[model samples]
Target: MTDLECRLLVIGGGPGGYVCASRAARMGVDTILVEAGRLGGTCLNIGCIPSKALIHVAALFDTARRQAAGGMQGISVAEPVLDFAAAQEDCAEKVATLRAGVGGLMERSGVKVVQGHAWFRDGKSVEVESETGTLLVRAENVVIATGARPVELPGLPFGGKVLDSAGALALTELPERLAVVGAGYIGLELGTAFARLGSAVTIIEAAARILPQYDDSLTRPVRRRLGDFGIALELNSNVTDWQAREGRLTFQSDGAEQVLETDAVLVTVGRLPNLDGLGVGELALRMTDGFIEIDEHCRTSMRGVYAIGDVTPGEMLAHRAMAQGEIVADIVAGHANGWDRTCVPAVCFTDPEIAVVGLLPGEPSEETVVSQFAFRANGRAVTLGDTEGFVRILARKRDHVILGIQAVGPGVSELVSGFALAIEAGLRVEDIAATIHAHPTLSEALLEAALMQASMANHG
Candidate 1:
């Protein structure tokens, strides 16, 4: 085993690890990052980047199909064929490119990266098993950002017929019939994409409604889009087991049993933190439930060992992990830093897309006031022919301070930054209402929503 020492050691080069390593190295701290797979981790390699790429491809393909059905506004074209292999190749290329960029940044920043699985040797040290050999690494500070993996159904294990998000993304051919096991963001996003790609998609949700975690107002348009696509939704359903031999899903819905035969089954129930290989249980670290318990400073119970991202608690968003990574790096480098986040934005890349920040809709708060501006009334949405959803703002009735912003419409995901910034900066309804939003733009919806909230009148 080769013995090495560094000022900081980060495990799993996901958004959290790589960011921490790079930032610490730039601060002149001797940092070493150990990763078993690619540097960009789940979000870059398989989760966020690749999924969004596929969604974009599916969207274009759907547009072509729509145009072919009955040319939109006099534009006529033949039906488009999706070359599935080529699309997968494109996603792979993008993932590879982004991963290589992350690798280059870590190298140029002087953070040493080791390709291996790291197991804890102690609170201050970890032993890595690499292709070259074994490595014994010790550091003054360590951060674990191993991230999470897709949750597989108990009865329908992942293998030939059942697929997790990664498996779904790696399809060589688009399935004619796709059975999605959940209706959360991951499932809905992929299921909707495949449906657009010409697959007869069936979404089986254990909850009573699709996107049960989100409010009805935010999810109503999404549900309407699914219905428009003729996508089958079996709500209040549970997959009992999968007959892998027969390629059928045996599920229970209503009172009796049911069977759904499909070309492929995509499961996106949830994610469990990647903890099996880390040997965290032996390190005497404080854990909550299954995740490592960390404070505002991202400090674990074990001294010198910090846990961030999916390995810790809170929202498992890539950007959140990145923010925590940067904060942890600064904190370790003798700079004062903590998890000072105002909003961790949640975006669902479903049809029309849904982006939310800050307080949830109908959240029990006496001081919060809610107002919405429908896209049907917005000129930009009407011109674009996407006037299906609306933009809503929740602010304090007492002070008019913006508490949360939620919207569902075309390109709302792109408008998430503006919403998050308003809340994070403690901007008021007057602040947004006073700003001059560009005419014939979707963001005008936000300004209008704010205006309507302040005056209690329509922005017509």
Candidate 2:
């Protein structure tokens, strides 16, 4: 076995691991990152990037089909033929390009990238089994950024007809009938995309409503849009079994057994921390609710050991992990840093996308005021012929301090950063109202919402 030593070792070469290793190395710290797969992890390779590409392609095809059926806005087009194989190839190429970029960045940053599976030997030592041979790595500090994987159902395992999110995305041919076993963001996003791509999509949810995390107001628009796309929603339903041979899915809904004939079944219930086979049992790390516990600086219970991303507690988002990785790198490099961000924005890439940051209506202890601006009244949304949702702001009733901002509409994902900035900067409603917004733009909705909260709304 070969032996190596480093100042810092980051496990799992994902967004968090790579970021930590790259930042620490740039700061003159000896750093090494280990991974068994591609450099970009799930987010860059399979989860986020690939899913978004599929959604974009599906949307393009759906729009073209609509134009072909009935001309919209005086525009007509011939029926668009879908080349599923070509679309998959394009998506794979994009993922490859991004992965190569990540590899190049690591090489330039001087981070020693080890392509292997890392197993913990002790708090400060690890054994990596690569294709070539075994390599023993000893480091002063270790960061566990091993991400999570999709949670499988009890009776239905991931295989031929039954698939997980990753398997669904990796499909070469689109299924004619798709039955998604969850209504969360992952399920909804993929189900919506498949529906647009001409699948008879059916969403099954145990909860009473779709997107239980968001209130009714935000999810209403997406629900309406799903109906418009002819997607069937089976809320308050529980999956019981799946017969792969017959392609039959049985579920319990409203105290009755229901069976669905589908070509594929996608299970996206949730994600569990990928701690198995890592030999975490070798270390006495503190864990809460099956996740590694960490402080503001992402320091674990063991000295010089840190954890970030899905392996640790908090939102399982690429940006959140990136932020934690930066703070941990700073602290490891003798620079003082901690997790002090006010809020982490969340986006649901559904039909009419949902973006939310900071407090909701009743999240604040003090009395709050809510202001809303519908997209139907926004010139840009109206002109685009896709005005289906609204922008809303919540603020302190007495001080007009903006507590939270959320929007559900076309391209709201791009607007969430501004919402996070507003909350992080402690900008009040009056501040947003005073700032001039360009006309004929979707952002004017933000100004209008703030103005309404300030009782000075110029537009409805």
Candidate that scores best on lDDT: 2
Clashes of each: 0, 0
- Per-residue lDDT tens digits for candidate 2, residues 117-179, read 999999989999999899999999999999999998998988989899999999999899999
Name the candidate that leads on TM-score: 2
Q: Give lDDT for model 1.
A: 0.90
* Model 2: colliding residue pairs: none
Candidate 2: lDDT of 169? 91
Worst-scoring 10-residue span by lDDT in model 1? 451-460
Off by over 4 Å in 2: none
List the candidate 1 regions with Cα displacement exceeding 4 Å.
Answer: 456-458
What is the TM-score (0 to 1) of candidate 2?
A: 0.99
* True-structure RMSD, every candidate: 1.1, 0.8
